[model samples]
Target: MTDHPLRYDINLSILFTELPLLERPAAAAAAGFTAVEFWWPFDAAVPDGSDVDRFAAAVEDAGVQLVGLNFYAGDMPGGDRGLVSWPARSAEFRANIGVALALGARLGCRAFNALYGNRVDDATPEQQDELAAENLALAAKAAAEQGAVVLLEPVSGAPRYPLRTAADVVAVMDGVERDAGADNLRLLFDLYHLTVNGDDIPAAIDAYASRTGHVQIADAPGRHEPGTGNIDIDGHLAALADAGYSGWVGLEYKPSGSSTDSLDWLPRARRSSS
Candidate 1:
């Protein structure tokens, strides 16, 4: 595939599973990635400071720039999408803001993916949305202080996830951006999820690429590498570049086999954000 006008970063959270968390950065670097991103490194929103320090040191030693991170999303394996809207987890989410920002700041990460919480049995859609807006406002403000942007993404395979379309996410962003008072809040623009949810990728890019803070790729039919499915990954990325999206394209897909082996499709020459 020809190179698109974009930077590339590996999502260590998904790509280097065989290794322990602390080891993933070096593994990515060995695989030719100079930049990486992750979901929360710890299962809990707040881990011991020592654990945090060790993770930071690991990335530092590996010499990979941490580009993007997610705010604490509770029990991802159990299907919880995020904590930004759940009333019960509001305190946890708020508490996580400081920890997330501090880590991102130290790593010089400019993008923070804030997964909107799922629909809870106890809260109505309106109530949950209201809470999400408030919480996102808080995150956006804090992220701005560190010169980073808080990203809201529409996720698929998440039945309870409220943001399933680009429109769904932008509806909320309209309010958050107005409140943020700067460009600190933006859409994540995951191509696979939007395609899975039936949004026209080209139209979505035409509408939202200018507002997108970050981008992720995974082919549809299966969330694997670009050529493993029917999605025209390269064309879409080229369109995004044409539409004014100039940011990291995070490789957030699940591998069909060994993570390193899954990367045979990506040339080492195109791995960095040069």
Candidate 2:
């Protein structure tokens, strides 16, 4: 067994993109990961029921646990990171919660990430923040019913998108809890984003571990697999373990070559633990 205490899960959305979405889980399983996570699988917030069934079947067939998932961010690759804060898109976000919850229930996923929407030309920052707080509060309640927690991630590389620091996300989480009267909302401590935004990683872990609901990692400067970039993956992970974060560390990196080629950082022994 590896010395590290954090369990690892592959992020099928960023890695394994060479294959079809439904085919990626089995591909991850074949590559030795026993748990996986993904962004919303459908282009639209509320996809057809048949689409959901097929996706569900794929995960069940792959035999991997779905440990984490994102609430529908508008167009991930096309520059729309999320819509939870957008006034015009709030309906689309609300429509996605039931679908996300059902899939989470099916996969026994307890972590649901809610990306804060970018600032819109038509809406003031206060308007978006208010909308986001209200929508996320609703999401927290829905996720709570499923015994899950809602996550807020501070993204880098998107300037208009607010919440780029650990403090920013936790503040939002606290506001969400206060507004909803539910404690199911927490921060998603993504190391890659934290590093990109220039936050001290170990300091972030020390400050936010208890309030963090989920964690994702990719090395800095390239968003590639661990050890390929400058981050001290081992040291930071040890810090997380020391801080009592016995949760899944999502491998949310882009593979330099084939997705399987990125397994060098993950030990063979630890890859198959569900």
Quick one: best lDDT, which candidate? 1
> Model 2: how far is 197 from its true place, Å?
0.1
Candidate 1 worst ten-residue window by lDDT: 175-184
Over the full model, what C-alpha lDDT does candidate 2 score relative to the true structure?
0.89
Model 2, C-alpha of 244: deviation from truth (Å): 0.8
User: Can you write out model 2's per-residue Cα lDDT over 1-274, one digit (the tens) per residue?
Assistant: 2358788899999999999999999999998889999999898999999999999999999999999999999988889989899988999999999999998999899999988889999999998999999999899899888789999999999989989999999888888777779798888989899989988888889888998888898987899988788988778888888998888889999988888888886887788774
State residue 169's C-alpha deviation in candidate 1, in Å: 0.7
Candidate 1 Cα deviation (angstroms), residue 137: 0.6
Q: What is the lDDT of residue 273 in candidate 1?
A: 66
For 69-96, candidate 1 gives per-residue lDDT tens digits of 9999999999999999898898899999
Q: What C-alpha lDDT, on a 0 to 100 scale, does residue 38 get in candidate 1? A: 96
Residue 165 C-alpha lDDT in model 2: 93
